[model samples]
Target: MRCSWLLLLPLLAACNSTPSAVNEGTVSRVADRQGRDTTTALPAPDTAATKAVSAVSDTLRVARERHNFSHAEGPSDLFRLVFRGPSILEGNAEFTITSPEGQVIFREMLTEPDLEAALVYEMKTPTATRAERETFVLRRIDRFFLPAQFHTPALDAKAGFPTDIANLERPTWDDLRKRPDAIGFEYLKGKEDRQRIAWSPLKKQVVRVQ
Candidate 1:
Protein backbone atom coordinates (compact mmCIF):
# COMPACT_ATOMS: atom_id res chain seq x y z
CA MET A 1 0.00 0.00 0.00
CA ARG A 2 1.19 3.50 -0.80
CA CYS A 3 1.07 6.26 1.80
CA SER A 4 0.67 10.00 1.48
CA TRP A 5 1.65 12.54 4.11
CA LEU A 6 0.83 16.24 4.39
CA LEU A 7 3.17 17.75 6.91
CA LEU A 8 1.64 20.94 8.29
CA LEU A 9 4.14 23.48 9.49
CA PRO A 10 3.28 26.86 11.01
CA LEU A 11 3.83 30.04 9.04
CA LEU A 12 6.46 32.65 9.89
CA ALA A 13 3.96 35.38 10.64
CA ALA A 14 2.09 36.06 13.82
CA CYS A 15 -1.21 37.82 14.47
CA ASN A 16 0.70 41.13 14.41
CA SER A 17 4.13 41.77 12.84
CA THR A 18 6.75 44.38 12.11
CA PRO A 19 8.47 45.13 8.80
CA SER A 20 11.80 43.95 10.11
CA ALA A 21 11.05 40.38 11.26
CA VAL A 22 8.53 37.57 11.39
CA ASN A 23 7.66 35.30 14.31
CA GLU A 24 7.80 32.01 12.42
CA GLY A 25 8.46 30.23 9.13
CA THR A 26 6.62 30.86 5.88
CA VAL A 27 3.15 29.49 5.38
CA SER A 28 3.15 26.41 3.08
CA ARG A 29 4.12 22.79 3.01
CA VAL A 30 5.23 20.36 0.33
CA ALA A 31 4.29 16.75 -0.01
CA ASP A 32 7.68 15.52 1.13
CA ARG A 33 7.12 11.85 0.18
CA GLN A 34 4.03 10.47 -1.39
CA GLY A 35 4.08 7.23 -3.32
CA ARG A 36 7.71 7.83 -4.27
CA ASP A 37 7.17 11.38 -5.44
CA THR A 38 8.64 14.33 -3.54
CA THR A 39 7.30 17.51 -5.04
CA THR A 40 7.13 20.74 -3.02
CA ALA A 41 3.77 22.51 -3.12
CA LEU A 42 1.80 25.55 -1.97
CA PRO A 43 -1.45 24.98 -0.20
CA ALA A 44 -4.48 26.85 -1.35
CA PRO A 45 -4.94 30.04 0.70
CA ASP A 46 -8.10 31.12 2.40
CA THR A 47 -9.79 33.53 0.05
CA ALA A 48 -11.70 35.47 2.71
CA ALA A 49 -8.78 35.57 5.10
CA THR A 50 -6.50 36.84 2.39
CA LYS A 51 -8.78 39.74 1.65
CA ALA A 52 -9.01 40.64 5.31
CA VAL A 53 -5.29 41.09 5.82
CA SER A 54 -3.66 44.52 5.55
CA ALA A 55 -1.43 45.20 2.56
CA VAL A 56 1.78 44.47 4.40
CA SER A 57 0.35 41.22 5.76
CA ASP A 58 -1.15 40.32 2.40
CA THR A 59 2.22 39.65 0.79
CA LEU A 60 2.78 36.26 2.42
CA ARG A 61 -0.47 35.05 0.93
CA VAL A 62 1.03 35.14 -2.54
CA ALA A 63 3.92 32.62 -2.44
CA ARG A 64 6.25 30.72 -0.13
CA GLU A 65 8.65 27.74 -0.07
CA ARG A 66 10.29 25.81 2.76
CA HIS A 67 13.39 23.62 2.91
CA ASN A 68 16.20 22.48 5.16
CA PHE A 69 19.26 23.95 3.45
CA SER A 70 21.43 23.17 6.42
CA HIS A 71 24.92 21.78 5.75
CA ALA A 72 25.50 20.46 9.24
CA GLU A 73 25.42 16.74 10.00
CA GLY A 74 22.47 16.14 12.29
CA PRO A 75 18.71 16.22 12.38
CA SER A 76 16.92 18.23 9.74
CA ASP A 77 17.52 21.95 10.25
CA LEU A 78 14.60 23.42 8.39
CA PHE A 79 14.29 27.08 7.34
CA ARG A 80 11.46 29.15 5.88
CA LEU A 81 11.52 31.85 3.19
CA VAL A 82 8.50 34.01 2.40
CA PHE A 83 7.88 36.88 -0.04
CA ARG A 84 5.57 39.80 0.54
CA GLY A 85 4.50 42.88 -1.39
CA PRO A 86 1.85 45.60 -1.41
CA SER A 87 0.24 44.51 -4.66
CA ILE A 88 0.83 42.59 -7.86
CA LEU A 89 1.46 45.87 -9.69
CA GLU A 90 3.96 47.38 -7.31
CA GLY A 91 6.81 44.94 -7.97
CA ASN A 92 8.17 46.09 -4.63
CA ALA A 93 8.74 42.98 -2.57
CA GLU A 94 10.29 41.91 0.69
CA PHE A 95 11.54 38.34 0.95
CA THR A 96 12.41 37.21 4.45
CA ILE A 97 13.98 34.03 5.74
CA THR A 98 12.93 32.86 9.19
CA SER A 99 15.25 30.70 11.19
CA PRO A 100 14.10 27.73 13.26
CA GLU A 101 13.43 30.02 16.20
CA GLY A 102 10.99 32.16 14.24
CA GLN A 103 13.49 35.03 14.09
CA VAL A 104 14.16 36.84 10.84
CA ILE A 105 17.70 36.01 9.82
CA PHE A 106 17.84 37.79 6.50
CA ARG A 107 15.65 40.24 4.67
CA GLU A 108 16.05 41.77 1.20
CA MET A 109 13.97 43.90 -1.08
CA LEU A 110 12.98 43.29 -4.72
CA THR A 111 12.70 46.78 -6.10
CA GLU A 112 10.34 47.73 -8.91
CA PRO A 113 13.20 48.07 -11.37
CA ASP A 114 14.62 44.74 -10.30
CA LEU A 115 11.37 42.97 -11.04
CA GLU A 116 10.71 44.96 -14.23
CA ALA A 117 13.99 43.79 -15.73
CA ALA A 118 12.58 40.26 -15.93
CA LEU A 119 9.72 41.55 -18.11
CA VAL A 120 11.94 40.91 -21.13
CA TYR A 121 11.36 37.21 -20.49
CA GLU A 122 7.63 37.72 -19.79
CA MET A 123 6.26 40.11 -22.42
CA LYS A 124 4.60 37.91 -25.01
CA THR A 125 2.09 40.53 -26.08
CA PRO A 126 3.58 43.62 -27.64
CA THR A 127 2.50 46.90 -26.07
CA ALA A 128 1.13 45.17 -22.99
CA THR A 129 -1.22 46.88 -20.57
CA ARG A 130 -0.12 48.13 -17.15
CA ALA A 131 -2.09 45.34 -15.51
CA GLU A 132 -0.46 42.80 -17.76
CA ARG A 133 2.99 44.00 -16.84
CA GLU A 134 2.08 43.91 -13.17
CA THR A 135 0.71 40.39 -13.45
CA PHE A 136 3.87 39.26 -15.18
CA VAL A 137 6.08 40.57 -12.39
CA LEU A 138 3.93 38.99 -9.69
CA ARG A 139 4.14 35.62 -11.40
CA ARG A 140 7.91 35.97 -11.58
CA ILE A 141 8.10 36.38 -7.81
CA ASP A 142 5.79 33.42 -7.31
CA ARG A 143 8.12 31.17 -9.27
CA PHE A 144 11.34 32.62 -7.87
CA PHE A 145 12.27 29.63 -5.73
CA LEU A 146 11.99 25.96 -6.68
CA PRO A 147 13.16 22.53 -5.59
CA ALA A 148 15.59 22.11 -8.48
CA GLN A 149 17.20 25.43 -7.56
CA PHE A 150 19.02 23.85 -4.61
CA HIS A 151 22.09 21.61 -4.72
CA THR A 152 23.01 18.61 -2.61
CA PRO A 153 26.78 18.86 -2.71
CA ALA A 154 27.12 22.62 -3.15
CA LEU A 155 30.72 22.74 -4.45
CA ASP A 156 31.94 22.10 -7.96
CA ALA A 157 33.63 18.73 -8.30
CA LYS A 158 36.47 20.55 -10.07
CA ALA A 159 36.16 24.16 -11.18
CA GLY A 160 38.75 26.85 -11.51
CA PHE A 161 38.86 30.61 -10.91
CA PRO A 162 41.53 33.26 -11.30
CA THR A 163 43.73 33.85 -8.27
CA ASP A 164 41.53 36.65 -6.99
CA ILE A 165 38.31 34.73 -7.56
CA ALA A 166 39.80 31.55 -6.11
CA ASN A 167 40.77 33.46 -3.00
CA LEU A 168 37.13 34.42 -2.59
CA GLU A 169 35.91 30.91 -3.47
CA ARG A 170 38.33 28.80 -1.49
CA PRO A 171 36.67 29.19 1.92
CA THR A 172 33.27 27.91 0.84
CA TRP A 173 34.71 25.55 -1.76
CA ASP A 174 36.94 23.81 0.75
CA ASP A 175 34.35 23.65 3.53
CA LEU A 176 31.64 22.02 1.44
CA ARG A 177 33.98 19.67 -0.43
CA LYS A 178 35.16 18.09 2.79
CA ARG A 179 31.63 16.95 3.66
CA PRO A 180 30.77 16.06 0.05
CA ASP A 181 27.10 16.17 1.09
CA ALA A 182 26.54 19.78 2.05
CA ILE A 183 23.34 21.26 0.67
CA GLY A 184 22.81 24.87 -0.45
CA PHE A 185 20.35 27.04 -2.33
CA GLU A 186 21.14 28.71 -5.68
CA TYR A 187 20.06 32.25 -6.50
CA LEU A 188 20.13 33.52 -10.06
CA LYS A 189 21.03 36.94 -11.31
CA GLY A 190 20.21 38.03 -14.87
CA LYS A 191 19.74 35.19 -17.36
CA GLU A 192 22.34 32.54 -16.56
CA ASP A 193 24.31 33.77 -13.56
CA ARG A 194 24.13 31.32 -10.65
CA GLN A 195 25.14 31.76 -7.01
CA ARG A 196 24.89 29.03 -4.41
CA ILE A 197 24.22 30.25 -0.87
CA ALA A 198 24.24 28.47 2.44
CA TRP A 199 24.08 29.27 6.14
CA SER A 200 27.47 29.67 7.75
CA PRO A 201 27.22 28.41 11.33
CA LEU A 202 30.70 29.57 12.07
CA LYS A 203 30.09 32.99 10.63
CA LYS A 204 26.42 33.11 11.71
CA GLN A 205 25.27 34.49 8.36
CA VAL A 206 24.17 33.48 4.90
CA VAL A 207 27.05 33.50 2.40
CA ARG A 208 27.71 32.76 -1.26
CA VAL A 209 29.32 29.50 -2.36
CA GLN A 210 31.70 30.14 -5.25
Candidate 2:
Protein backbone atom coordinates (compact mmCIF):
# COMPACT_ATOMS: atom_id res chain seq x y z
CA MET A 1 0.00 0.00 0.00
CA ARG A 2 2.88 2.44 0.75
CA CYS A 3 4.53 1.61 -2.66
CA SER A 4 1.22 2.22 -4.51
CA TRP A 5 0.80 5.62 -2.75
CA LEU A 6 4.36 6.59 -3.77
CA LEU A 7 3.72 5.78 -7.50
CA LEU A 8 0.52 7.95 -7.61
CA LEU A 9 2.51 11.12 -6.58
CA PRO A 10 4.61 11.12 -9.84
CA LEU A 11 1.49 10.70 -12.02
CA LEU A 12 -0.31 13.54 -10.16
CA ALA A 13 2.79 15.83 -10.55
CA ALA A 14 2.96 15.14 -14.30
CA CYS A 15 -0.74 15.84 -14.69
CA ASN A 16 -0.42 19.18 -12.84
CA SER A 17 2.60 20.21 -14.99
CA THR A 18 0.78 19.67 -18.31
CA PRO A 19 -0.97 22.75 -19.76
CA SER A 20 -4.78 22.98 -20.30
CA ALA A 21 -6.29 24.09 -23.66
CA VAL A 22 -9.33 26.30 -24.35
CA ASN A 23 -11.15 27.81 -27.31
CA GLU A 24 -12.75 31.27 -27.40
CA GLY A 25 -14.34 32.82 -30.42
CA THR A 26 -12.15 32.06 -33.41
CA VAL A 27 -9.02 31.85 -31.26
CA SER A 28 -7.50 28.80 -29.52
CA ARG A 29 -5.34 29.17 -26.41
CA VAL A 30 -3.72 27.38 -23.47
CA ALA A 31 -3.33 27.98 -19.74
CA ASP A 32 0.14 28.77 -18.33
CA ARG A 33 1.81 27.25 -15.27
CA GLN A 34 0.29 29.96 -13.06
CA GLY A 35 -3.25 29.07 -14.39
CA ARG A 36 -3.48 32.20 -16.56
CA ASP A 37 -4.70 31.92 -20.22
CA THR A 38 -1.77 32.30 -22.65
CA THR A 39 -1.59 35.74 -24.27
CA THR A 40 -0.53 34.21 -27.61
CA ALA A 41 -3.33 33.19 -29.98
CA LEU A 42 -2.88 30.39 -32.51
CA PRO A 43 -3.32 31.22 -36.22
CA ALA A 44 -5.28 34.51 -36.49
CA PRO A 45 -8.66 36.06 -37.00
CA ASP A 46 -9.25 37.10 -40.64
CA THR A 47 -10.71 40.59 -41.22
CA ALA A 48 -12.65 39.51 -44.31
CA ALA A 49 -14.81 36.84 -42.67
CA THR A 50 -16.58 38.91 -40.04
CA LYS A 51 -20.29 38.78 -39.28
CA ALA A 52 -22.61 37.31 -41.96
CA VAL A 53 -23.61 40.16 -44.23
CA SER A 54 -27.22 41.38 -44.04
CA ALA A 55 -29.80 41.61 -46.82
CA VAL A 56 -29.00 45.29 -47.51
CA SER A 57 -25.52 45.48 -46.06
CA ASP A 58 -22.24 44.41 -47.71
CA THR A 59 -20.24 45.04 -44.51
CA LEU A 60 -19.71 48.46 -46.06
CA ARG A 61 -22.81 50.09 -47.54
CA VAL A 62 -26.47 49.52 -46.68
CA ALA A 63 -29.78 49.88 -48.55
CA ARG A 64 -33.34 48.54 -48.49
CA GLU A 65 -36.72 49.26 -50.13
CA ARG A 66 -40.17 47.67 -50.26
CA HIS A 67 -43.47 48.47 -51.94
CA ASN A 68 -46.87 47.05 -52.72
CA PHE A 69 -47.56 46.64 -56.46
CA SER A 70 -50.88 44.93 -56.31
CA HIS A 71 -53.15 45.31 -59.36
CA ALA A 72 -55.49 42.38 -59.48
CA GLU A 73 -55.78 42.49 -55.67
CA GLY A 74 -57.84 45.10 -53.87
CA PRO A 75 -56.49 47.86 -51.60
CA SER A 76 -56.40 45.47 -48.63
CA ASP A 77 -54.17 43.06 -50.52
CA LEU A 78 -50.74 42.37 -49.05
CA PHE A 79 -49.04 41.79 -52.41
CA ARG A 80 -45.62 43.38 -52.22
CA LEU A 81 -41.96 43.27 -53.31
CA VAL A 82 -38.75 43.95 -51.45
CA PHE A 83 -35.40 45.23 -52.76
CA ARG A 84 -32.18 44.38 -50.97
CA GLY A 85 -28.58 45.22 -51.82
CA PRO A 86 -25.45 47.02 -50.64
CA SER A 87 -26.37 50.38 -52.14
CA ILE A 88 -27.66 52.10 -55.23
CA LEU A 89 -24.19 52.53 -56.74
CA GLU A 90 -22.75 49.09 -55.98
CA GLY A 91 -23.64 45.41 -55.66
CA ASN A 92 -26.41 43.41 -57.33
CA ALA A 93 -29.95 44.02 -56.02
CA GLU A 94 -32.51 41.28 -55.45
CA PHE A 95 -36.18 42.08 -56.13
CA THR A 96 -38.67 39.63 -54.69
CA ILE A 97 -42.45 39.77 -54.75
CA THR A 98 -44.90 37.64 -52.81
CA SER A 99 -48.61 37.06 -52.96
CA PRO A 100 -51.06 37.94 -50.18
CA GLU A 101 -50.72 34.40 -48.86
CA GLY A 102 -46.88 34.69 -48.73
CA GLN A 103 -46.15 32.68 -51.86
CA VAL A 104 -43.31 33.97 -54.03
CA ILE A 105 -44.94 35.43 -57.12
CA PHE A 106 -41.96 36.92 -58.92
CA ARG A 107 -38.23 37.30 -58.39
CA GLU A 108 -35.38 38.91 -60.32
CA MET A 109 -31.76 39.72 -59.66
CA LEU A 110 -30.94 43.22 -60.87
CA THR A 111 -27.45 44.46 -61.60
CA GLU A 112 -26.20 47.93 -60.72
CA PRO A 113 -26.75 48.95 -64.33
CA ASP A 114 -30.46 48.12 -64.10
CA LEU A 115 -31.03 50.32 -61.04
CA GLU A 116 -28.96 53.16 -62.50
CA ALA A 117 -30.32 53.01 -66.05
CA ALA A 118 -32.57 56.02 -65.47
CA LEU A 119 -29.46 58.04 -64.67
CA VAL A 120 -28.64 58.19 -68.37
CA TYR A 121 -31.71 60.34 -69.00
CA GLU A 122 -30.65 62.66 -66.18
CA MET A 123 -26.97 62.79 -67.12
CA LYS A 124 -27.46 65.40 -69.86
CA THR A 125 -23.98 66.58 -68.90
CA PRO A 126 -20.95 64.63 -67.71
CA THR A 127 -20.95 66.81 -64.58
CA ALA A 128 -23.43 64.55 -62.77
CA THR A 129 -22.01 63.79 -59.31
CA ARG A 130 -22.31 60.62 -57.27
CA ALA A 131 -25.02 62.22 -55.10
CA GLU A 132 -27.11 62.99 -58.15
CA ARG A 133 -26.89 59.41 -59.42
CA GLU A 134 -27.88 57.99 -56.04
CA THR A 135 -30.83 60.33 -55.74
CA PHE A 136 -32.07 59.28 -59.15
CA VAL A 137 -31.93 55.65 -58.14
CA LEU A 138 -33.86 56.40 -54.97
CA ARG A 139 -36.55 58.23 -56.88
CA ARG A 140 -36.74 55.42 -59.41
CA ILE A 141 -37.41 52.95 -56.64
CA ASP A 142 -40.14 55.18 -55.20
CA ARG A 143 -41.90 55.23 -58.56
CA PHE A 144 -41.30 51.56 -59.34
CA PHE A 145 -44.64 50.47 -57.87
CA LEU A 146 -46.60 53.68 -58.19
CA PRO A 147 -50.01 53.76 -59.83
CA ALA A 148 -48.62 55.75 -62.77
CA GLN A 149 -45.97 53.11 -63.39
CA PHE A 150 -48.76 50.53 -63.64
CA HIS A 151 -50.50 50.97 -67.00
CA THR A 152 -54.18 50.09 -67.13
CA PRO A 153 -54.49 49.86 -70.89
CA ALA A 154 -51.60 47.50 -71.47
CA LEU A 155 -52.41 46.91 -75.15
CA ASP A 156 -54.36 48.59 -77.91
CA ALA A 157 -56.54 45.96 -79.56
CA LYS A 158 -56.69 47.90 -82.84
CA ALA A 159 -52.99 48.75 -83.06
CA GLY A 160 -50.37 46.56 -84.73
CA PHE A 161 -47.35 45.39 -82.73
CA PRO A 162 -43.78 45.42 -83.95
CA THR A 163 -42.95 42.74 -86.56
CA ASP A 164 -39.90 41.75 -84.55
CA ILE A 165 -42.07 40.49 -81.66
CA ALA A 166 -42.42 36.72 -81.49
CA ASN A 167 -45.56 35.24 -83.09
CA LEU A 168 -46.43 33.29 -79.97
CA GLU A 169 -46.47 36.53 -77.90
CA ARG A 170 -49.14 38.09 -80.08
CA PRO A 171 -51.89 35.97 -78.54
CA THR A 172 -50.84 37.02 -75.04
CA TRP A 173 -51.22 40.68 -75.95
CA ASP A 174 -54.57 40.02 -77.53
CA ASP A 175 -55.84 38.23 -74.46
CA LEU A 176 -54.59 40.94 -72.02
CA ARG A 177 -56.28 43.80 -73.91
CA LYS A 178 -59.66 42.13 -73.53
CA ARG A 179 -59.45 42.28 -69.71
CA PRO A 180 -60.38 45.80 -68.62
CA ASP A 181 -58.82 45.42 -65.17
CA ALA A 182 -55.45 44.10 -66.35
CA ILE A 183 -52.46 46.16 -65.23
CA GLY A 184 -48.74 46.14 -66.14
CA PHE A 185 -45.67 48.07 -65.19
CA GLU A 186 -43.67 49.57 -68.07
CA TYR A 187 -39.91 49.78 -67.64
CA LEU A 188 -36.95 50.96 -69.67
CA LYS A 189 -34.00 48.74 -70.52
CA GLY A 190 -30.72 50.64 -70.78
CA LYS A 191 -31.56 53.96 -72.46
CA GLU A 192 -34.49 53.35 -74.81
CA ASP A 193 -35.95 49.83 -75.02
CA ARG A 194 -39.23 49.96 -73.09
CA GLN A 195 -41.04 46.84 -71.93
CA ARG A 196 -44.12 46.09 -69.83
CA ILE A 197 -44.70 43.17 -67.48
CA ALA A 198 -47.59 41.91 -65.36
CA TRP A 199 -48.67 38.94 -63.29
CA SER A 200 -51.21 36.95 -65.29
CA PRO A 201 -53.89 35.22 -63.27
CA LEU A 202 -54.76 33.11 -66.31
CA LYS A 203 -51.22 31.72 -66.65
CA LYS A 204 -50.46 31.80 -62.89
CA GLN A 205 -47.15 33.51 -63.79
CA VAL A 206 -45.61 36.72 -65.05
CA VAL A 207 -46.35 37.82 -68.60
CA ARG A 208 -45.11 40.51 -70.98
CA VAL A 209 -47.46 43.15 -72.38
CA GLN A 210 -47.11 44.99 -75.68
The Cα local distance difference test for each model comes to 0.57, 0.60
1-210: candidate 1 lDDT, tens digit per residue:
122222222233442444232223333333444545343334555686554545435554345676665535544443333444556655366666666566666666656556556577656766778887777666666676778877776666665532533324556556655655666777554444556676665556766665
lDDT digits (tens) for residues 111-203 of candidate 2: 667777768666879677889877876665555555565666555656575556553365666677787667666766555667676666566
lDDT of model 2, residue 84: 52
Best of the candidates, lDDT: 2
TM per candidate comes to 0.56, 0.57
Q: In model 1, which runs have C-alpha deviations exceeding 4 angstroms?
A: 1-61, 71-86, 161-169, 189-193
Cα lDDT for residue 63, candidate 1: 57
What's the true lDDT of residue 205 in model 1? 72
**Steric clashes per prediction:** 2, 0
